[model samples]
Target: MKVLVMKPQELHKLELLLPQDKIAKVIKKLGRQISEDYEDKDPILIGVLKGCVVFMADLVRSISVPIEMEFISASSYANGRTPEEKVDMSGGPEISIKGRHVLIVEGVVDSGRTVQTIIGQLRQKEPASIEIVTLLDKSKCRLVDIDIKYRGFDVGDDFVIGYGLDEAQKYRNLPFIGKVANE
Candidate 1:
């Protein structure tokens, strides 16, 4: 899909990576799969915030099972394209994760540092189980090994924006995902 953003020069610099319809289909499929898998488990859907907000919102609606939702803010992209070795995490879930099945939703997995840190921290809470679901996976850029149970797309090493992913905190509101030009 081609988007002709006549006004915004930044938008014009983007090339479509994944269209909205494809993303929606992936989300719906994932939601159904999660609902089926955790039908009786009553898992908690923990969204990695800022980026996961849009994906989480749509994902929960597609799910047909009774579930709880929470948010955690973690980041390693404060300075550059490549993630910092360390991650900063804040605003964890209010509810206890002890003995509960936890499903973490992330918008993108690049270096795996931030999510790895989050998993390590969540492990201290003694949750019954922990799984990760990500919208975009860039395995080529992974610095550390991590398992993503559910993945929407496995993209090459490109700076992607839109559909809750961003660069410098912009383009996240776009319904479709795009690869940033000259990145």
Candidate 2:
């Protein structure tokens, strides 16, 4: 068997899905909703890196309510695009979650196994509430049930890249989301 490597330039050949302007509009709206919901309570936004880095940054700035930010590295696709049986996680928030509202921000959600695991772990810390906010939702690929309180866009099962979502650790810096061609 031989391995086929994709050239860097080929990554640029993507079909545009979510443009930058539209993404910004949706994020602003989500910010308003989240601010209103957590106005009286202190909410901690836990970002799932490294995909959530870009989305989380913009989202935090858009919200009117005061918020704390934390990050954890978790992935079901540790070695490849396809998810594995178990999710690998590390670097949880140092801040105590007990009695505080928690928001898990994700760049995209598919099988939901990883998010479910994160929720279970946080629940053990006894947060006042736990909610999910994802930039993109691929409901068609969901293998487990997860409630998302805030969502920026609903997408199909297409493999997307850009705006923090990567293809082979590339195309993450693109400002817009695009579907991988021939994927």
Candidate 3:
């Protein structure tokens, strides 16, 4: 069997599906909303690393209000020993959330297991509130029900990549999200 690379048609299809400028515009609006909502409150932004670094950076720069940032890495997927499994916490940061508002920045919320674990663990720290902000939400893939406070995009199930998302660890630098084009 011969495997073909991406074609212009597939690229055009993806462009029609998701506009690059639109995505940026939505993110900027989300940032403004967060700033307005937390104008008087100082929230600790906990970025879920590896997956969310792209979204986190954009989100941090978008917010008008000052916010502190920390990282929390998790991977419940058992090292992909079983692709069907969910993500696990590789490890958490040393940031203190006690009595402080916490916002989790995430790239994708597929199974909801990663966020669930983070929330559960942070809840024990005595934080006043904990919320989530995800760039992409795939409702079809959610194994657990987790409420998201802010969302940039709610998209259908497709092996998406680019704009900080990678496939086989490549093409994350693409300006827009796209799938491996079938020829």
Candidate 4:
């Protein structure tokens, strides 16, 4: 399948939600908390690909603890704005997670289904523990119960983009988080 690339002006108007400086401050705090909690225990951070790229990169840098990084592909939004009935989950961490602490890093947690699915898959690997860390949490849109150990911010039901979040696989390069105004 071919992808359509449009000029920036053609995209929907965006309203700034989280500025870069603020996001950075919050991430630093989260990193400190995680570092303290997982002290001495080396943890593996598994990032959900496509969306989590930017956030995960920044978050990992802020973390003071020694952590192994990995990437996995898990998405409920294949193309459209609303989530599809079935979440597409693939890819696995190359490193062994057996008897090790695992932290799943996510850019956004909306329906909670994708995270749940990932946790279930990782459980099979016999990890000693598993936790979640998300940059944005859309708790109101959750269809299933999920515990987010670390959360940067909570947002309403606005279609958000930028800072690794995208619409039609676009706007991931935007430095700050924004809501599509006309969406």
Candidate 5:
């Protein structure tokens, strides 16, 4: 089968979904809220890798309270838009999560499979508390229930890219979030 590759410039045709300023505002609000909620707990900000890097970086900076940060890599989109039943995870938290307040940060939540799986695994580690914060929430596509403590935007079910989210590992460097054309 021939692989179809999208040129970087072709992304210009995508519709702008979330601008940088808007994303920043959301992150700032989330950061402040997290800081206030965890003022005494000293939470560990765990980023879901590959996609959460950009959002996590900005969010951590916006947060005023001191906190620890770590990354866990996982993916369920090996084939297409719909996530696979299984999640492939690696490089989980290095420190002990037992009794620690863990916060999972994600770029977007669509099917909720990947994040849900991660949360279940983290629960096994016996953290004091676990919560989720996502930059974008696509509730229309959710196949499972997830409690998102903080959400930046509620978007329709569309293939989005930018600000850390990607398409075939491309378009992640875009400064703003946008929906793929015809998807």
Candidate 6:
């Protein structure tokens, strides 16, 4: 099967949604905010594996303070595409977040279900602070209504991919964010 992204007369272009320069500016701005917030403290950034890898990498590099980075692999995808399934989290295979300032970096926030589950699991460690940071903030379909401390972008009701967001495990290498065109 093939995918049709755009039609000449569709009047909507993927390139218009998220510009490359804006994306860079937003990421750098967030990094500055984080640096100021933890100027005198050592912050531990926890990157949710797979999706958030690219965003986490960029954010960590931009941060101007000494910080530790860790990885946490967890999944909440259940059968099909229905969003009512309970997400299952995997205990981080390496490193411990106990008594650390944990900033969970994610690709995007849609329903907030998967991250919510992960946060619950990590709560047992009693970290000094647990905050959520996502590259894309979709408030239109947020089910849990969680406050994303560091949001790179606030988008509308559109399916977005690229810049670490993927359709089916692809398009993570695209420099700018794009949305699927609807017929």
Name the best candidate (by TM-score).
4
The sequence of per-residue lDDT tens digits that candidate 5 reaches over residues 1-183 is 212335765523577878899999989999999999999898999999899999999999988888999999988888366677788899899999999999999999988999999999999999999999999999998899989998999997988889998877887888889887673
Which pairs of residues clash in candidate 1, taking residues 3 or more apart in a chain or in different chains? none
On lDDT, the leading prediction is 4
> What's the CA error at residue 30 for candidate 6, in Å?
0.4
lDDT of 3 by residue, 10-100 (tens): 4322333355798788889889989998897899899886767777888889999989998988755443312245555656657777988
Model 3 accuracy (lDDT, Cα): 0.74
TM-score of every model versus the real structure? 0.93, 0.93, 0.83, 0.94, 0.92, 0.85
User: TM-score of the candidate numbered 2?
Assistant: 0.93
For all candidates in order, the CA lDDT equals 0.88, 0.89, 0.74, 0.90, 0.88, 0.76
Q: Once superposed on the true structure, which residue ranges of model 3 sit more than 4 Å away at CA?
A: 1-17, 76-83, 181-183
Write model 1 residue lDDT over 1-183, tens digit each, in one string: 555443346445678999999999999999998989899997999999889999999999999999999999999888466788879899887999999999999999999999999999999999999999998999999999899899999998998889888777777899999886672
Task: Name model 5 segments beyond 4 Å from true.
Answer: 1-12
lDDT of 2 by residue, 33-106 (tens): 99999998999999999899999999999999999999999988865677777999998989999999999999
Per-prediction CA RMSD (Å): 1.9, 4.3, 4.7, 4.4, 4.3, 4.5
Once superposed on the true structure, which residue ranges of model 1 sit more than 4 Å away at CA? Answer: 1-12
Candidate 4 whole-model C-alpha lDDT, 0 to 1? 0.90
Query: What is the clash count for each candidate, in the order shown?
Result: 0, 0, 5, 0, 0, 0
lDDT order, best first, reads: 4, 2, 1, 5, 6, 3
lDDT winner, 2 or 6 = 2
Weakest 10 consecutive residues, lDDT, candidate 2?
1-10
User: In model 2, where do residues sit more than 4 Å from their true spots?
Assistant: 1-6, 9-12
Q: Least accurate stretch of 10 residues (summed lDDT) in model 4?
A: 1-10
